[model samples]
Target: MFNLYFISQSTCSILLLLNFALKNVACNPVVRTKSGCLKGSIDRNIDGGKFYQFMGIPYAEPPVGDLRFKAPKPKHPWKGIRNATEEGSACPHRREKRFNQSVPLVGDEDCLFLNVYTAELPRNSATMKLKPVLVYIHGGGYVFGNGGRAKYGPKNLMTEDIVLVTLNYRLGILGYLSFSDPTLEIPGNAGLKDQRLALRWVQDNIRRFGGDPNRVTIDGESAGGSSVHFHVISPSCRGLFHGAIIQSGSTLNSWPWGKLDGAISVVNKIGVKAKTQKEALDVLKSLSAYELVRVLEQMGITECSNDWQDISPVIEYPHEGAFLTKSPIDILNAGEQNQVPLILGYNSKEGHWMNYQQMAAKAMGTWVAPFSWECIIPWQTGIKKGTAKSKRFADTLERTYQTETPEENVVNAWSDSIYDVGIEQAIKFHLKTHLAPIYAYRISVITRLNYLKRSLNLWDKPGVFHSDELGYLFSQSITPKVSPGSPEDIYRRRIVKLWTNFVKYKNPTPDDELNVLWQPVESVDPIKQLDIGENLTFVDTPEARRFVVWNELLEESPFIIN
Candidate 1:
């Protein structure tokens, strides 16, 4: 009898192990996309919320060889199941570094991929109710950034019942180089075209992943945010998305848009001695991706400058597949944009991250004040440098935000000119023209989760720095782990809820769970904005005095403020 019992127990153990193996096999989910079948991995959030992740899914064919400078082509159908368990290579660009550290260029030319995270999959496509979708565009000044899981993990966001998608587009010179000679066929905004293709992929395949095709919202920050606003104005992107979340960026921002002069300067700096644009195109195409990036880096080319970026969105000559043929301002002024529900805002101290070194130098008593503040005037204002108009604008800015210390004045000036003024202008225009609800906000919440500031050792510094709000919305590997019920965790939950709620209802405050009634901008006289901090409060005309100063200074300027 004892021998028999021992044999039975061993048999039961073997059966249990086999059952677990089968369960493990079941956990690897498969979803059918229009291109082919994709096998993905499963993950759990911090709170044990289970979700499915499909990574490294190609949305476009490799933009290589002859396709280098051209717009992305739609991905062709594959033969069998593609393994999407791993992330695709990042687009070709130099990795972002701190304090100007030189990092190795990482990624490949065939990097037009996207990732999808969903809490549930449709068991029966005819009966299951699809969830709303949020497609995120990463912000790296349109120079560096990818939709990989390491930085933009879905742990925080997947807890909500929504489908989240993040994607990669071409960046830097490869993405934005343009020429007036349309014969070369390298109309700029190929990166934006990549994004549009990804969105089209979502519209076609998201339903199979349990996402509603009709209820898709596009969200992005910084350059990505500006990209969203660009989509709002671009005719090519009409009907691609139903809603938008523009964080700390706007089409009105001068830095993101440029003209042919800037493009010509980049070519000249690259030592391309082409008499014609076609010759320049051939030279650029012959160079390796790494070589192009290396030359640009040696030339000190970066996404951000007081002037337009060396590589940036430009008005393309009218031709087939031209992404943007006219000025975005003209599009908005003519009310010819894709009007959609929008949630747009900026961090309280958007320039703190940009001027942290200056702040540190001042703290050490080694700071030297600039002799002339004329450089503080943004180039978008179109007021010629050293002119009376430029000097007057500079003087007014100095008087408006100048404090006893030069560091404070510098931060304020940079913040207003780079972010605040443009965002406020966007809000004003939306309120005056669009019938859709436009919710404007200013995030002033200072906490340990202020990722950018804390990473730069500026946590002790005053005000929330640019991209500080990212920590609360997405779970990144670099951020500190949040204790279950801590204030930081609560803040994270609050932010994620607000954003996902907007994704679901198009109104952040659909209910009173958070105890705040977030309202939309109704009038430009006193632009109503939600101040998101320890407590959500409705403030009338954020930084009104400073905006008034900017308004009067740029009243007669050619750049579009109205």
Candidate 2:
């Protein structure tokens, strides 16, 4: 239990560099960042170890008004010790009015902030020992999500003696929409630049919070995983972090930068149109963020899932001041970026959730149509009756996945269809090009205490979802919390040890504690996969049941050209 003490809000005064000292500290944790001094609260009831949490600290100035659709600027220095103990607003996003119905987009535009959780502060940068750092990015298809969710609380992970950081960035049209213009007015990848600025803040200020800048690890799930993948290849972000953990995502996921010209033509049909590209840019800038996001949502739902390509990171021309200079495949093949230890993998039953989604959409058939959730194809649209293109796609899909239930087959086929072309291909390419350790995993565990199932009227169902690993490591920070004897408690420790081990040292397997020796895939071995489930096992990466058929069809058909 913490010995309770309080730092008066009225008494905080600016301290000069010449007179700065830790002697005047109260029970709360106070550290001076490059931009300003921050005061945070101490937790008394954390099971493993009580820690300090500095919440909603501004890393960048609000990206509103003239700064919209541009790279972030560092927060200007404050005059007094700023309080950083509350959560900040999340980026703007669109929500479905109903299960397949069009809805108005909603969120705030001034949502660029980061949070930090640590055990203690260093008096001086030179003499103090520091711990490894972990920065997490949340995923919602680069369209919807926030970093400060309650489930992402770092109270449990900090027990392993590492610093935890999470951040928010621009989303939807404000973040990823780009056009082919003579002037690079809407320089894409502003969201990624927001992330890069947050990393820079950590590098410059984390030392004061007892984190080593040289030992930082960037970790993310889903689209956030893809963001980390882009950072690995980004030239502007060299040396920003030392390691990466990408779960259930890759650069090839959803948006793989083929041709945006087709997408730009689509953009012109519905949105505020003007005669010239410059006029279009001016018209777009004139619209409010909410209006812009609503228009993008409408457009996204109208197109087929595969061709909804306008809402992701882009391959900018050289010296264009964008995040990715070339495409992800181009960069990975050329080997022209930072090299770091990486832990990447996908969950078992990733497509099970997609199947459920399809079923739900059908059951609620009365709900409005054209409800497009990014990254998920509709249950009925793959087999449209019109063109040869549709027939080829449908025929190949039918051949690839055949089962008792045709609907379920389509659902199960999603895993390989999505990953085989995305994560799986990226990993195979990475092994050939990079010599750094590559530890791939497949998480197949189904939790007994799945809260979503019970709360959402889905009972007795068992499946490991795309983001199910998150609950074991990051519990909902609330009452009736996970108990010490529960499976969640046990797995939390095991998972944290594996991840922090990779951060502290360049290996996931520990030297002292008992752990499965997760061996890295070598040049000779095409597959050495770690399976984390009810029991941990290392097995040959089994070829997906649908791989052969899918591969043959993709090679033969002209529908799905790379």
Candidate 3:
């Protein structure tokens, strides 16, 4: 992500006038921004109306060579105007070829680009007024994702009175490896820094795009939600955004620095070592990016399941006490994080989407694909051991998701025990420190998407599955196979209303006939689960039991213990 330096309005207007004059005063043409902008084309098909779109705007310089693992640096100022009408390249990552699904292809190392959508062209001085900003971070387990993905088109989101911003960040080995030298404090989590840089960029130039930097709301799902959790605690991210929305993912998957020893060992297998931290960093940075990815793959580093070997943020080592300090939990506990309004939540049946039984059957029956071979076994076994804790944790889970043996049971158990529980912990932490209004929900919209619904047969899993709410919340049409009668249609409307309401008012209360008031999570009887389905309900009960079981499982007997 790009480092940002904000110049005052006088400076901004002067820059604007100069840019406008350079362009010969085009019709409501958006002048190139400081990071360098290009005029966008108008599209009538988007958002039920015509909207202006600017794609592939660079937020940071490329993270290649020695800059790979360091904090993102600002892009060098451009001279002539740059073309941003087309989407920019996505970051480099190992692509997974899936059935009927075209995987997002590889692009470039300098993938810190963004796309913007607005109702109309900024009409000169009128567009300079501050409008609320909605900055979205995409989700891919911190390993795969880019803002270029079509699922996140901002046409509808932009139609509202909000400025929509979407971005891409470094992923995989390129983003999260921790170099083992004490002096090389900045080894891991360059991707997170990339996110902060993007936010900083938004703060600096969003006004030019008709957005209020101070009223920005950072939002995301899955890994992106985890990113929001990190932002809540990160000192570097303190002033970058005013509100946050974490959907379906949290920092529960995060492992402390010491837990990464195994991953560090693999990173060292390239026959490169150093006496000091700086020397170590120099040696690692010197290796080509391909060479680094190759070495991590060869050593079974990248093969490990997501939980056992984490790519999530940790307090930066060496600089842990300094530069990048505090995990989400730490910040919340100390009451030191940004105490802004929040909408943090998860799905009711988050694990059903993984389809652990099918994955395990495949892993057990065949020669695992290189990626699957390395990832499946350890991940499956890990979750099984942890699932032995509670009946609700075990029975309810296994009933919906069946496995041949105890091993598969462990895998499914670990997935929920680790992931779903993490969100619960975050909720508890937020309540401890934050006095601001907190709205939480449990996405219960069971999709008509037969594939996802069929997978739910493992047991009678309820209304929600991990990410099942995305399509609905974004108002994406349901699959033709999923019967979308009145019930399904109403479910879609409710989710869209909840999300858009949150974006507009910093709360999920919608101004419609189907509206329902949501209560803030507080010290007493803190759990608030909004069942977002054909019929919405308010569930007020403590969500701590599951948290307790899962936390214990993580502490005492991790299913995927390294």
Candidate 2's C-alpha runs over 4 A off are 1-26, 44-48, 94-106, 182-184, 256-271, 300-305, 356-397, 448-459, 477-480, 512-514, 523-526, 540-545, 548-562
Candidate 1 vs. truth: CA RMSD? Answer: 6.8
Q: List the residue pairs that clash in candidate 3.
A: 382-559, 382-560, 383-410, 383-414, 384-410, 384-411, 400-458, 400-459, 444-463
Clashing pairs in 1: none
Q: What tens digits encode model 1's per-residue C-alpha lDDT throughout 76-132?
A: 987555778999999988775411434578899999999999987776667999999
TM value for model 2: 0.85
Candidate 2, 200-285: lDDT as tens digits = 99999899788999999999987788889889888889999999998878776654333332335435756545666566556667
lDDT of the candidates, in the order given: 0.79, 0.67, 0.60
Indicate which candidate wins on TM-score. 1
Q: lDDT tens string, model 3, 325-394? A: 5455556778987888888887765655455434653554422232222132234234432343433344
* TM-score head-to-head 1 vs 3, winner: 1
| TM-scores for every predicted model | 0.91, 0.85, 0.77
User: Cα lDDT for residue 346, model 3?
Assistant: 76
* lDDT score of residue 172 within candidate 1: 78
RMSD of each: 6.8, 5.1, 7.0
